[model samples]
Target: MKANPGSAAGSPTPVVEAKPCGNTGETVTERALRLRVRQQEILAELGVRALRGTPYPELLEYAVQCTAEGLEAEFCKVMEYVPAENRLLLRAGVGWEPHLVGTASVGADLASPAGFALRTGKPVISNHLENEERFRTPELLVEHGIRRAMNVILQGEGRPYGVLEVDSRSPGEFGEQDIAFLQGVANLLGMAIERQRIERDLRAMVEEREVLLREVNHRVKNSLQLVASMLSLQANATDKPDVRHELREAATRINAIGRAHQRLYRSNDVRVIDLAAYLVDLCADLNAAWPEGEVVARTPDEPVPIATDRAIPLALVVNELVTNATKYAYPGRQDGLVEVCLDQAPEESRVVLAVRDAGVGLPPGFAPHASTGLGMRIVTAFAQQLKAELRIRPLDVGTEFSLVISLQAPDRAG
Candidate 1:
């Protein structure tokens, strides 16, 4: 959750007043008790709201940066925890250019608050930046004309999640009270970040499940093809010619159905056909099976993405038409031509698949309702399945069949 709500210009005008508590004659123990009470009130309010109401995604970053900059500090920054790396990374900061805004990370160690917080699961404070001996690089603040800073650890689920830091260009900017208040803000930020990470992981899991289910469907399609092949072998070994012919046609159509899944199953694309690639392979197989005539295939340069429902029927329709072109369209002629072409239709919603043949035109009378041939029925069924318009026209030299169905990107639907 690298959600930096604070603008680059700096946090919005703070509503709270900023002041310094002059060091009086109070004992160190008394002063610490008062500062701890202030921290308690801030944390209690934060906890109440988080438990009672919905929180905005950017609220945590907003509060951290706003509170720090509101304290009239010279430089302020917040670092979010990266659990995978077991480190706190700088996410947002003021008084720095774009280069320094998302700078780097600080692993858990004595010098960095992120490191100390993870070790103790509590906030760490540096009362003075200029006179502190623990810091090896005091020039970091002197170079930027900033002298003081404070660090607060954000705890989520009892683990350190990040740190809230406030710095000033002057030598003595933050006191003990300021440190305590920022620590409360850091605690709120940690809880919000933890919640956001969980939601993100859940969303990724859901998408992964969808992909797995699609893979399972693809596998089922392959199994169906194996079943069809087994029946084909049984038919070939039988003596009855009539049974053999019916079984043979059934096997062919079933294989055509299987081919659709076979292609889709092998691809990572769950819904979309490399219709161009699919047609090329389908035509090659048909050519080998019925090589008496020449069948030429063509497709669009761009890819066409059709969902499962539309893709299955579209592939089978092409299968039946091409199979027929090989069988009957070139009657008594060994040297005819079958050409397949695919192109994006007008309106960009449909793709046109056209199969043309240089052979005798459609048989004398091929009425859909009266035709009993398996090939004609297959074409009609698939056309209806794809919600496509199937047109058969008599050309000057031969016949042409065109199937048009609207195309949609897989992202738009299943």
Candidate 2:
């Protein structure tokens, strides 16, 4: 606790005068002992009240009033340290003029009682402000007729937060007990102030972390898009049909993943993706890339939120299947129709994704497990990663590929 510059020995302005025991005829010494005990009891109760979760300002105000009432001082105040301003700001007070509670500030120099206590980490006591020589008398105290004062530093974690002080219009000496009681009140007040500071810091950290995460996702999306652009440029420049086809295909795959990252960056929650929006955007990109086929996606009215780890693989599976249908499903037509459907099972924990084409079905004697084609292999691998079953059915005039993903899997499909 901080020190007070003034001594505690002097006459007191009678804020509250000690009265004789009624009809008991008790000795002066006994009466003084009883009064001291009662004072301790009041301080103890106020200490408990201070520990409650009341607003800091209200509680601090109550604490100062309690100090004044308990010690029979006419005035009391709590001041908070502002290091940047190098001043002690009055946070709460009792018996001060109304304008002074929020407006008063004192220099945090050796001349001020609050500053003296903060510097020395000890209690300061003054019996007569008029005769005090340890520190210059503050004008506010003199204006209010304060003659006696005691102050203690409000310290937390061994660092001073501010000061708690009680003053009187009368002059009198303050005993060691008075100083000790004020110190106790300061200790309790310090704890509350510390708790608020820590909470504010934690909230700031959480907000900062969210901002950083979004920035990382945004940068990643931009970088991936750059790579996709490079692949497109390379594909357009190549003269070999097969090499150009491979590069375009690579670019589409990179662009598909980039779409997912971009969506997450724009979303409020980074941990989950709205799969419906994701599929629509993916299909739109595919239609533009492969204008020979018209790609369309259908989804439910409510949002379909998928975990981050699962959304990427799910999007890729759809991309590969739809691209294959556009390439091989329609042989003679310039514009084939490919439909992608996403639905949640009505009675089971599963998602069913179906991609269908309105053109000639798969070639005769085709087998999914034995197919050496890259598209077929990729579809099968993604199906296994999602812990879903893959099925291909030949339509009367086209082909359909379906995957039923298990939502309860221990780990998300690849």
Candidate 3:
């Protein structure tokens, strides 16, 4: 039986008995063992919640409530050290007035019990707060008529965060065994708080990098556009037909690259491109370039994500194939149809891009590898760079250029 601290002066201190586990009459040793087991169970539960990454505010609240219940104490709290003010803020707690929490402060100097624990990196227990001679009792405790208290330092990798303290108003002694349980709870809370800090820092770094990358893409696209415009002006100034034709072709290719960068600048993910959408946009540009002829794009409705590095080369290749068909496919006509198709190969890990025209066929027995034309040479170089297969089929009245590219895993941002 234990004496009630709230009993009046002239009346008998009412006795409270510890309940037995069963009707068999459990011994004192058995009761102590049961209490220890229950404490261990509570610690295990807190550990699991910490590992699962529970938010720090919720985790701290749970820790204090469970610690108080495990010790059968009346009050528990987690204090955050405010180095600037040299005090501890009541960050989370139970058994305190709602208004006091998050607004109350306690001394963090060696003269106070909690302060001594934080400074020495050791736990403090004062079973008799009224007659304690080593440290002065805090006014907050005195106001609540606390008879005993325990303090444990909460620390992580570097400096100490603060302290975890439990107080009791009832008449009881806080033993050495109680310190171990309280310290365990403080350790888990410290580690969890550190993890949250690291995660927040990493997320901020990633966001900053993404913003910088998007800015770089935007600048590159503008620079390429400027260069292409300069080339177009030079092509118009030249009097020689051959020089004019070559300069215009060079400008067209530069514009294609600029368009790819523009897409990256506008996209949410800078590492990859949507092949279907890129093809549709490219076809629109080609139609505007060759208003006399029509260029049609046929692609799957679903998005096909491709790495940014490969997307530029694929766009350039498509541009070259379509250009060739529009120039030489029809001998003397102004109106012709060129089709560009993108699809996945059936039952195979490959994608096929084909450009076909129905105006005229390739010269008899012509070989792409043996061709000396600058366009064919450019196509062959880019195809080798991509490690893709290039196939040309001669139709009855025109030609079809097909590029078979092996699909690769999507690239992830580091």
Best by TM-score: 3
TM-score quality measure for candidate 3: 0.83
Candidate 3: stretches off by over 4 Å: 1-25, 96-101, 131-145, 347-350, 394-397, 409-414
Better by TM-score, candidate 3 or 2: 3
Q: Tell me the deviation in Å of residue 313 in model 2.
A: 2.3
Given candidate 3, what's the lDDT at residue 21? 51
Tens digits of per-residue lDDT for model 1, 251-317: 6667666767777667666666677777777677567545676667787766666676676677677
Work out how many backbone clashes candidate 3 has: 0
The worst-scoring run of ten residues by lDDT in candidate 2 lies at 8-17
Worst 10 residues of 3 by lDDT: 7-16
User: Between 1 and 3, whose lDDT is larger?
Assistant: 3
Q: Rank the candidate models, highest lDDT first.
A: 3, 2, 1
**Of 1 and 2, the candidate ranking higher by TM-score:** 2
